[model samples]
Target: MTTTRDKLEMVLARLAARAEDERVFMGLYPEAARAAADAADDRRLAGVSLGPLDGMLVSIKDLFDVAGEVTTAGSIVLRDAPPAAKDAAIVSRLRQAGAVILGKTGMVEFAFSGLGLNPNYGTPGNAVDPARIPGGSSSGAGVSVAEGTSEIAIGSDTGGSVRIPAAFNGVVGFKPTARRVPLDGAFPLAPSLDSIGPLARNVQHCALADAVMAGEEPHILDPYPLAGLRIGVPRGRLFAETEGMVEIAFEKTLGLLGRTGARIVDHDIDDLLRAMREATLHASIAAIEAAEIHADWLTTRAEDIDPRVHHWLVRSSAVPAHIYLRMMRRRRSLIEAMDRRLAVVDVLALPTTAITAPLMAPLEADEVLYNDADRLILRNTQMANQFDLTSVSLPLPHCERPVGLMLVARHGSDRRLLEIAAGIEALLAS
Candidate 1:
C-alpha cells in the first residue's frame, strides 16, 4: 500500500526530477536525497520519526559546504576545490533531525551580490515572472522553495540575500539575528553580518527551519494576537524610495495588520539615512574575503571567475583599513538606536523590497550587471543587518503583484517574530 509518506515523497521526486532544467540548482545530489528519503520513509513507517520536519526536503545554497561536494558559492573558480570533508554545521543539524538534503542551489558568485545573478551558472527564473530576476546570493534557494523543489530552503543573508528573493517570490524568508546561526561550515560573505536562514511556502515552515539552522528545539510557538501588539511604522530612511505598486501593497498590508488590532505607531529616526551607506558593506566584505580565499587561484585563473564577481572583488580589495573598521563600528551604534525605537513595538512592519524583480534578459544581453542593481536589492533588507534584528518576510494577497510585508523584532526575539508571523500568515491566507 502507498502510504501518506509515499505521496509526499512522490511529489518530491517529481519536483526534483525537473530541478536541473529550472536553473535553480547549482547541483542536485539525487543519490544522497534518495538514500536519505528511503531511510526517512522507514522511520516514518515505524512511527519513529524525529520531528514534524523529519521527512522534509531542504535545498541549500551553494555556499554551504556539504561532504563530497565542493563549496562553490556559484563560482567556476572553485570547480577544482577538494570535495568538502564535512557538511557545514547547519547542514549537519538539519540532517540529524531527518531533513533530506535535496541539493545545492545556485547563488551569486561568492555570495557577494544582492540580486541573484550568476553569469557562469545562469540565474534561476523568478517564479512570479520568468522575465524577472530571483534576488540573490540566496537566489536558487528562494526559487527552490517557491517552486516546491524543496520543502524548505536554507540560505545565508549578508544584507538582504534571503529576504529579497522571498519578497520577490511571495514566500516566507527569515533571517534570524546574525549570531543565532553558527557559521562554521558555510562560505563566508561578511563575517560580521552574514547569517544562515530559510525560505518556505509559509511562516510555520520557516520557523521550523530557523530552529534547525540555529540548533534549537524546533517547536512551533503559539500564534500572535495583534490586539495589544504594538507595530512600529518606519518614518525615515527606510521608506525613502518606494516603488509605485510596492507602496500600495505595503500600505494595504499595514492596514490589514492594523485591523488585526495591533497598535500602530510611527517612528522617526533621522540617523537611518546614514545607514544607507551600509548597502555596500556586504559586497565589500565579501569581495575582500573572496580575494583572501581565492588569492592564489586569482593570480593565475582570474578569468575563471564570473567577471562581475571579479570586478566586485577588485573594488573590495581597495577598501581602506580604517574605513572598514569604521563601518564595523557604525553597525553597533545603528543597532543600539534601532533597538531603542523597537522598544515601543512588538515588531516593526514594512515592505521587504522597494520594488518588484527587474528584467534580467537585458542585463544578460549586455554582459554586465548594472551599477544600481545592489542598491535596489539591498535597500530594504539592510535594516535587519544594520540593527541585527530577527526578521521574516510574509507574503501579501489581493494583488496581482506579490509583496512581502516584513516584520522585524529585536535580537533574540526570533521566536516571537515567528509567532507573530504565523498570525499574519493565517490572516493573509484567510
Candidate 2:
C-alpha cells in the first residue's frame, strides 16, 4: 500500500524540481505537511481512515487565512497585515478531515483579474503549455492539480476564479452556491458573490473536497443517469465570440450527451443577461464592492496596487451610491427571474470560457490585449455569480488546448450539479 508519506515525498520532490521562477505556490508547508502525512500513515497502519480526503495532498489559494501567517491575497500591499489568529473555516475543516495541505497557491492580485496575471508573485504558466496564461484568480490552484503536485486545490470563485483556471488547465473545478461554504477567514474580492470551491483531476475529488469544506458528510457521488437528463444550452450571447476550437469541443460534448439520451435544447436567457449588462454598465457589483473594500488603500496606497485592478476600482468608486443601490435592487429581481426561468431545466450548459488560454507574452506586453482577454475570459463564467447559481467546469477531452464544458444550475443545487457533472464526466470519458 502506498503510504501517505510516500505521496507527500513525491509531491515535495516534484515541487522542488520546478524552477523558482515558475511560482505555482506562494508558500509551502513541507514540515507541517510531513507531520500530517506521518499521522495519517500511522492511522492507516492502525486500520483507521479519516475519510475520502484523509491524507490527500491539497493546496489552498493565498486568500485563505492560515493561522500565524499573513493572508496576502496575491498582493504585495497586504504583506504587512497582521498574521491570522486562526485558520480559515475551510482550512480547519480540511485539517479535521486529514488533508495534508501542501501550501498556499498563487492567485491574481486581490483575486481581481480573470487572466491570472500577478505582478507581485509570478504567474504560474498553463499546465499543458508553459507559454500560455494560466487562468485566474485561482491560477495556481488549477496548475497544482493538473501538474500532480496537489490532488485537490481550494480556490475562491467570485468571477470564475476557480473554473477559468480549471478550463485553461484541463481540470475539474466546482463553484458551489455563494454562502454554501463558510468564508469567515477568506480575503474577499466580492463578499456577496465569493464562493469557496475546489479544483481537482476529476469530479469525484472536487465533490469530496467541496463536501469537506462545506462541513457536510462526504459521500460517494451517485452519478445522475444521463438518459432523460434535461440540459438547457443558453446558446445566444453566451455562445457568441467562442473560439472555433472551444465551440467545436462544446458542440461535440453536447452531441455525445444527446446520443446518450440526454435532452439538449436551446434555453435563451439573453434578455436577463442583457439586462444585467445594462444595469452594471457603470461598474460590476464585484468591482464596486471591491472598491469599497479597498477604498482606503486606493486613497493611501494607490501606487502599490496593480494598475489594472486599481484602475477598475477607481472607476467603480466613482459610481454614485444611489446608482449602486438601484443596481443591487434590480439585480435581486433579475436573480428571481433567472431562478424562475431555470425551473424548467435541470442545468444550463455552455463553454466554460470563450477562448483557450492566450499566449502570455502578448497579454503581458499589451494593455489592450490584456483587458480584452480578461473581459472575454470572464464573460461566460461571471454569469453564474451575477444570477446566483451553482456551476462547475468539466474539461473537454481531445482539444489541442484545454477547454471546458460548463454546467450551471439554480442556486443551492450544488450536490445535484455535481451528480449531473459526474454523469456527464463519465459519458465523456466513455
Candidate 3:
C-alpha cells in the first residue's frame, strides 16, 4: 500500500509549484498535514485505519473555519478577523474521519457569484481551460481537485458555487439538501440557501466525502439500477440559452440514459422558472441575507469588499422588509408546487448551466458582459437552490468543452439523488 506520507508529499510538491498562484489556496498547512498523514500511516501500520477517508487528503474552502485560522471567505477584508477558536462543524467531521486538511482554497468573495472572479485574490484559472472561468464561488476547491492537489475539495453552494466550478473543471460536484450537513462555521452567502458539499473526480468520491462530512459511517453504495427509473426533463426556458457544445452533450446523455432503460418524461416547469424569476426581480434572498450579514462590515470596510459584491449588498440592503417576506412566502408556495411536479419523476435532468465556461478576459473587461454571463451561469443551478432540492453535476466526457449534466431531486432526497447520480455515473463510464 502507498504510504500516506508519500501521497501527501506529492500534494505538497504540487502546491509548491503553484505557491505564487494565489488563486488556488488562501492558506497552506503543510506542517499540520504532514503530521496528520504520519498519524494516518501509523494507524494503518497498526491495522486500525479509521475509515475510507483515513489518510486521504482534502482541501477546505476559505469560507470554512479552520481552528486558529481566520475564515476569509475570499475577501481580504476579514484578514484581521479573530482566528476561529474551533473548526467548522464539517471540518471537525472531516478530521474525525481522518482526512488530512490540505488547506483553505480560494473562492468568490462571500460566495456570491457563479463566475469565480475575485478582485482581492486573483481568480484561479480553470483547470480544463485556463482562458475560461472555473465556476465559483468554490472556484479553487474545484481546481484543487481537478489538478490533483487533493482527492476532494469541500465547498459551499448557495447558487451553483460548487456545481458550477465542478462542471467547468470537468469534475463531479454534489450539493446535498441544505439541512443534511451542518454549516455552523461556513461564512454565509445566503444562509437559507447555503449548503456544504464536495467536488471530486467522480460520483463515488463525492459520495464518500459526503458521508464523512455528514458525520455518518462510510457505507458501501450499491449501484442504483437505471432500468425503469423515471427521469424528468423540464420543458421550457431552462434550455433556452444553452451553447451548442452543452446542448449536444446534454442531448447525448439523455439518449444514453434512454438506451439504458430509463424512462425520459418531459415535465412543463414554466411555473417553476416563472416563480424563481419573479423572486429575482423583487426579492433577492441572497442579497437580503448577505446585506444583513455584512451590515457592520459594509458600513466600515466598504472599500475592502469587491465593488461588484458591494453593489449587490447595497441593493440587498435596500430591499423593503415586506418585499423580503413576500418573497419568502412565495418561495414556500413554489416549493410545494415543485414537489408535486417532481413526484412524477425520480430525478430532474438538465444542463447544469446553459453555457460552458466563457472566456475570463471579456468578462473582466466589461461589467455588462460579466452580468450577462453571471445570470446565465446561475440560471439553471439556482433552481435547485430556490426549491431547496438536492442536485449533482456529472461531467459529460464527449463534449468539446466541459459541460455538466445536472440531475436534481426533490427536497430531502439527498441519498436517493446520490444513488441515482452514481448509477448515471457508472452508465456514462460504461
Candidate 4:
C-alpha cells in the first residue's frame, strides 16, 4: 500500500484527518508525519530500506518520553518531567526503522491498575464490547492496534499491563525478557518488574515491532510442528485457581496443541510463585521502587494524582529496606531454580491472566473491588516478570471472557520464545 511519493506521509495524513466518530479506543499524534515521510524518502533514494518494518505507523504507551510531549503514564503527576530531551530508546528505534511515531497511546494511571481507567484523559474505549473493560496500563496500546489506529503499539508491562489489554481486545501482546529492551527513558511503575513489550495484530507483528524496539536483528520464522517441542503444563496447581470456563478453554487449547504433535508435560506453578515471593516483584518490591521514583512528586503533587494512584504511592513508601533486601536474595534463588527447570523444557505455558476482562462501569465505581480485581488480573503474568522470563501472551478464541496463553523462556531467550509462541498461535488458529 506504499508508493514512492511520501507514502508514510500520506498514511499519516489519512490517519490524522480520519473522523473522530471513528474510534475513541486509542489516540494518535500524527504531527510528526512530514518528518517521517522525509526520512522514508531519504531511505528510498539511498537504495536501502531501514528494515522490513520501514514506513509504518507505531503507537507508544504514554509512559515513555516522546520528546517535546508529556510522559503522562496515564497520570497527572509528571506533567513537567522535562518534556523528554529525546524520544525514549524504543521511540528512537522505531524512527530508525522508518516507522512513523504515530502518537502517545493511553494507559492505566501510574501504570498501577489492570483495568484501563483514565479519570483525567478518559479511558480508551474497548473496540470489542463497549460494556467490557479495555484492560490496562497498556490499555490503549492494545486498542490502538486492534482498531487499526496504529499497526503496532509499544507498552510497558509492570503487572500484566501489555498482555491483559491484548487478551481483552483480542490481539497479540508479548512481554520480552525483562532486559531485552532498554528502559532508559521509559517511566517506571515498579522498576524491577516493569518491562516494555508490544501489542499488535498478530504474533508476527509483535515480533517485527519487538525487533525494532529492542534494536536487534529481526528473527522471522514460519510456524512449525509442536512435536519434539517439550511444552510444560503446570497442571494441578496453576490450574487450581482457574474458573470453570477458563479450565475448559485451557484444556481445549492444550488439546489443539496435542493434535498438532506437541509434547505436553508436567510443570508446577510453585516455581514461578516462589520467585515472585523472593524477588519481591509484587507489592513490596514494586512499591518501593515506585516510591523512590515519585519521592519528590509524592510530597509536592500528592493531591494532583488520582486518589487511587495516590493511595498506592502512599502505601509504596512504607516498604522497608530489610524486607526489600531479603526479597532480592529470594529473587536470585528463584531465577536459578527456573533456569534449571527451563533447561529441560522447551517452553512453559500458562494462562496470561487468571480471569477475563472485568466490566468497566462496575470497576469504575468501587475502588476496593477494583484493587482485588487488579491482583486477579496480575496473578499469572507477574510471575514471568519475577523470574525475568521472556514471555509472550497470545489471545485464545471461542471463549466468553478471552484468555491469553503465556509462553515463557528463561532469561533472554526472547527470539526462541517468539518462534515457539508463533507455532502455538498457528496451531490454535488451525
Best candidate according to lDDT: 2
Q: For residues 173-260, write the lDDT of model 1, one tens digit per residue.
A: 9999988999988988778778889999988888888887788888977898868788888767778777878889888877877787
- The C-alpha local distance difference test score for the whole of candidate 2 amounts to 0.94
- What is the number of residue pairs that collide in model 1? 1
Clashing pairs in 1: 116-136
Give the per-residue Cα lDDT of candidate 4 at 179.
Answer: 71
- Pairs with steric clashes in candidate 3: none
Q: How would you encode candidate 2's per-residue C-alpha lDDT over 1-430 as one tens digit per residue? A: 8988999998888778775665999999999999999999999889899999999999999999999999999988999999999999999999999999989999999999999999878889999998999999999999999989999999999999999999999999999999999999999999889999999999999999999999999999999999999999998889878899998898889889999999999999999999999999989999999999999889789888889889999999999999999999999999999999999999999999999999999999999989999999999999999999999999999999999999999998999999999999998888
RMSD of 3: 1.1
Task: At residue 412, give the lDDT of candidate 4.
Answer: 83
- Give the best candidate by TM-score: 2
How does each model score on lDDT? Answer: 0.80, 0.94, 0.89, 0.77
The digit string of per-residue lDDT tens for model 3 on 370-414 reads 989998999899889999999999998877788899999998888
Better of 1 and 3 by lDDT: 3
Off by over 4 Å in 2: none
Q: TM per model?
A: 0.92, 0.99, 0.98, 0.91
lDDT of 4 by residue, 188-287 (tens): 8887888899988788889998887888886686665588888898765456567667677877888888876778988776856754664664455666
